[model samples]
Target: MIQIKDLHKSYKMGSNSLHVLKGINFNVEEGELVSIMGSSGSGKSTLLNILGMLDEADEGSYTLDGVPIKNLNERVAAKYRNKFLGFIFQSFNLINYKSALDNVALPLYYQKMPRKERMDRAFHYLEKVGLAEWSHHLPSELSGGQKQRVAIARALASDPKVLLADEPTGALDSKTSHEVMELIQGINDEGKTILIVTHEPDIAQMTKRIVNLKDGIIIDDHKVEQIRASQYV
Candidate 1:
């Protein structure tokens, strides 16, 4: 579903350039559940940004679902990003003023989907995430796990080709993390391509494959016997 080759990225810091990703290469097939692991200064976040089209690589290639992801104008880039990628971040990234249902419907709003259709779709996903009863609650009114579920629902509401999660469980307690992972596992079971960036070993074990990144390159990539998150939840 996604491919990357000889990917390189750098940023200027006054007089010197800080190389973040150097010659990174990998491919994630359709329906695969993968984890990208790295410590501080590793390029996992940068890689996710490039994949999400929020940033561009200085060198190399990225192809998502058969289309090249480079040299696009902002308008085209935004269009592709909206159509192809869904994101979940550690911070939840919800608008505090908006109710959970409105937050999920926001993306569909940008897609110019009809009001009734967007709301209906958003509610369906919220229901899928087990948040239907709390749909009217604001982000501030929900617990950490509830907020994350709302965020996940919002991500899925777009029905994108890939789901990229950056430290998705970083902020939650262990039990809540497992519950969220359980939900994620069920999603993958239905054939959604997911890439999670996490440092926790237990969290990484839940995925079908793990890709370890050091400095700027993939140091190890292998498939594992998947651990069902439901056992822990």
Candidate 2:
């Protein structure tokens, strides 16, 4: 679960300040799959960064699970981030030289999990994402969808509370994109809270709820009948 109220963010450009998020407010319940939809410069990325605790808001409040996320020291923030958030980026963010299994195992390694358990968990998640057979492949050896699946497995390997995805399907072809969305939808069905930041209407529709952002504020927020990505895949 997540909550935000009256959130505001801005960046200084020399003498001028560019406002990115103004009076943003929203909550995501446990197990809900939600998409934040916006055009470029509409503040979706700023909102996602704040939600992921990768950046701080200039004003307002953000509470993840039950802890206040404000004014925390970097060490504490990193701890909370590792304990609660899993991130997926459009670029996949895999190390070029790491095999898929090693990439998925990296987060657990950072957590200091035992090597045996880390590899077991990594292989489990890779299997969950239908990438077990590709475990030895590097990012360069896999298709875009396979790479994204590896990324998804890496994100899940840590067993975080929420998955924060930025433009998850942006870099793939339509069929591959839908395939990835289908995988995401399956994850959400198992009660993982997911917040996806995407501009694509069709991508947003795959989630249960859509929050439309414009001019740095939420313009519309509503739940809709979910569209199954498997249909398109």
Task: Report lDDT per candidate.
Answer: 0.96, 0.95
Q: How well does each candidate superpose onto the true structure, as a TM-score?
A: 0.99, 0.98
Model 2 clash count equals 0
Q: Model 1 misses residue 206 by how many Å?
A: 0.4
* Candidate 1 residue lDDT tens string, 106-214: 9899899999999999999999999999999999999999999999999999999999999999999999999999999999999999999999999999999999999
lDDT of 2 by residue, 100-182 (tens): 99999999998999999999999999999998899999999999999999999999999999999999999999999999999
Model 1: residues with Cα > 4 Å off, grouped in runs: none
Query: Deviation in angstroms for 115 in model 1?
Result: 0.2
User: C-alpha displacement of 130 in model 1, angstroms?
Assistant: 0.5
